[model samples]
Target: MLVLMLSLVLSDSLVLADSLALADSLALADSLALADSLTLTDSLALVLCDSLMLWLVEELSLADVLSLSLALTLCDSLTLAELL
Candidate 1:
């Protein structure tokens, strides 16, 4: 009877060890999935930032062109006034 009790205890400990290992594996998988998701999010953010910068550059270029044209018109008017 004592031997049977010892066997039962050993088997219970083994089962406990297996459950702990399974829990650790599940936790590690969850962490890996989170890391992958974060990486994807970062990539998308970078793309959005790049597109916004391009749009801003285009807007600035348009403003620059308008300013240049205005300056040229002022210069022409001044030249005509001096001639008159």
Candidate 2:
């Protein structure tokens, strides 16, 4: 009968819609998971970079202090020689 055929078509359409929705949900979940992992990786890289920068800054500061001390000693010696 025509009514029976129409009912069958409607049921098939509903099933197809449900399948598409489920597929979309799965795809969204996968995308979110990938984004979270990338964020974590970026955060870890940033932490490592920050530590490296701090270490380099400390080393450079130490070298600067040593150079300044040497310069001050040389200036004092020159002054003393001139006075003598």
Candidate 3:
């Protein structure tokens, strides 16, 4: 579970990296699916995505490796695109 969470974080951190739109959308979709599928009450993925969403609004920025730690820190409330 931890590995899955970490990988998802790392993967999302890679989005908004100036990549091709198709690739970005696909990646975002995959992350979204994973986040949606998680059944845990804590739903760390959701929390991470929430923080990421918050950061996105603040910075209007997305960079590889950006906002990963921020999401990880809010491990309990994360949902899909937690920051968004």
Candidate 4:
């Protein structure tokens, strides 16, 4: 009877050990997946920032050209008034 009790306890301990190992493996997998997702998110954010900078530069250049044209037009009108 004592032998049987000891065998039962040993078997239960083995099962518990197996379950703990499985839980650890699952936790590691979840951690790796989260790291990969964070990396992907960082890459996407960098791409969006680059696109925004390009658009801003284009808009600034366009505004500069329009202002230059307006200044030239004003100078021409002033010269015409002086001649008249």
Candidate 5:
């Protein structure tokens, strides 16, 4: 009886994981559609990137001086490994 209950719970989790994947796919499609409608110029992109870089740089520790994005990634093991 316990085994039967465990199997049911496990199956439910598989269904949830599959659903999550489907949702992610839909989100990606929506994002692509939005990007397709936007017009970003090269100069504006560079300025935005510079501003973002400055923001990230400002978040670094005094001693280490790593970028803020890198610091945030270091806090999570999966992201750290993926970044490397």
Candidate 6:
């Protein structure tokens, strides 16, 4: 009877060890997944920022062109009036 009890205890200990190992493996997998998601997020953010910068540059260029056209029109009108 004592031998049987010892065997049962040993089996229980083995089961506990196996469960601990499984838990550790799951935790490691979770950490790796989180790291992968963070990297993807960073890459997407960089793309978004680059796109925004390009849009801003285009808008500024358009504004500069409009301002130059306005200035030229005003100058032409003034010259024409003086000639008259």
Model 3 spans with C-alpha error above 4 angstroms: 1-19, 43-49, 52-84
For each candidate in turn, the TM-score is 0.45, 0.44, 0.29, 0.44, 0.46, 0.45
**Model 4 alpha-carbon drift over 4 Å, by segment:** 40-84
Across residues 1-84, which tens digit of lDDT does each residue of candidate 3 receive? 999999998888676454677687999999789767776664655565566567656655555335555555455464454544
Question: What's model 4's TM-score?
Answer: 0.44
Candidate 6, run of 10 with poorest lDDT:
75-84
The per-model lDDT (C-alpha) reads 0.62, 0.63, 0.63, 0.61, 0.61, 0.62
Per-residue lDDT of candidate 5, residues 65-84 (tens digit)? 45544554343333323433
Model with the higher lDDT, candidate 2 or 5: 2
Candidate 4, residues 1-84, lDDT tens digits: the string is 999999999999999999999999999998677557655645454454445446556666877656644543354333322422
Better of 3 and 6 by TM-score: 6
Query: Clash number for model 2?
Result: 0
Pick by lDDT: 1 or 3, better one: 3
Compared with the true structure, the alpha-carbon lDDT of candidate 4 equals 0.61
Minimal lDDT window, size 10, model 2: 75-84
Q: Which portions of model 2 show Cα errors greater than 4 Å?
A: 39-84
Model 1, position 67, has a per-residue lDDT of 65
Candidate 1 residue-wise lDDT, 1-84, digit = tens: 999999999999999999999999999998678558665645454454445446556666777656644554354333322422
lDDT of 2 by residue, 33-76 (tens): 85576656454544544454465566668776566445543543
Q: What tens digits encode model 6's per-residue C-alpha lDDT throughout 1-84?
A: 999999999999999999999999999998678558655645454454445446555666777656644554354333322422
lDDT for predicted candidate 5 compared with the true structure? 0.61
Deviation (Å) of 73 in candidate 3: 6.2
Which ranges of candidate 6 are over 4 A from the true structure? 39-84
